[model samples]
Target: MEDKELKDKLLLSKLKAEDKLKDRILHQINAEQALIPKKRKSKRASKENYFSIFGIMYAVILSLGVYFYSQTEKNPLESNTFVFSVIFVAGSFSIYWFLMVYMNYKKVKQ
Candidate 1:
């Protein structure tokens, strides 16, 4: 019948209009995303860089402690105390560094 044919044409037109709207919305979204800028390095990466720098400084201090301990030929008691203090400080720094690294790893994993 003509009535049924007219209904089918109307339905087809409605579907086509919806498809065009969807495509336009998608294109706008893509254009907006393209205009946005992305960061090159993350916060985690900057923290890792800071850790590395501190690690190098720790190594230097430990090496200096060793050098001083070896150079001190006289005053055995003074040398022993100095070495003990250096070792204690180095140990504490090492433990703290390991804990920070573990915490960062856990955060990243989650």
Candidate 2:
């Protein structure tokens, strides 16, 4: 009976030591993680940035179209086709811009 009791006590002590070792390992891992700096996630350009850039481009293209139209009017030798194509492209861009704005608005509303 005494031998059995001694064996049980030895087993309990070993289990307690193992538990302590596990706890120390976990604590060390947590401390190392805390000391390490987390990397920042990169973000793509936002809708506002896209809008601002495209808005500037749209304005420039429209202005150029108007300038060319005026020039074509003054110089009858120049064809109006180039001005018409510019206007068409500008109109397409404006449509796409408005659609994107509407989709963003809807997403925000949700």
Candidate 3:
């Protein structure tokens, strides 16, 4: 019937208009995203860089500990204390780094 045809045409027009509106909104969102500045490094990459730096620091501290231990004959108590302190610092840094890695892993998992 003509009435049914008119209703179908009206429904089709409504759908087309809705599709156009959706496209417009999507374009606007994309345009806004384009205008935003991108970060230089992602979170994972920066974290990796930080961990590498910590690794280097750990190696240096370890070398110093060995050197101090080697020189312990001159002043045993002083050298022991210095070596102990270095060991404590290295342990703390390692624990903290592992905790950070675990936290990142959990975050990624979620």
- The global C-alpha lDDT for each of the candidates, from Candidate 1 onward, is 0.67, 0.64, 0.69
Position 72, candidate 3: lDDT: 65
Clashing pairs in 3: none
- The positional error of residue 46 in candidate 1, measured at the CA in angstroms, is 6.9
Report the CA-based lDDT of candidate 2 relative to the real structure: 0.64
Instruction: Locate the minimum summed-lDDT window of 10 residues in model 3.
Output: 35-44
Task: Write candidate 3's Cα lDDT for 1-110 as tens digits.
Answer: 69999998888767335668988999999997864433222365547856785887688777776767687645434665776877777777777777776766565555
TM-score of each model, in listed order: 0.38, 0.36, 0.44
Q: Which regions of candidate 3 deviate over 4 angstroms?
A: 1-15, 18-23, 28-40, 73-110
Among residues 3 or more apart in sequence or in different chains, the pairs in candidate 2 whose N, CA or C atoms overlap within 3 Å are none
Cα lDDT for residue 2, candidate 2: 100
Candidate 1 residue-wise lDDT at 57: 56
Report model 1's TM-score to 2 decimal places.
Answer: 0.38
Candidates 1 and 3, the one with greater TM-score: 3
Candidate 3 to truth, TM: 0.44
For model 3, state the Cα shift of residue 87 in Å: 10
Candidate 1 local lDDT, 1-110, one digit each (tens): 69999999888777435678988999999987754432222355647756885787577666766767578855444676666766776777677776776766675455
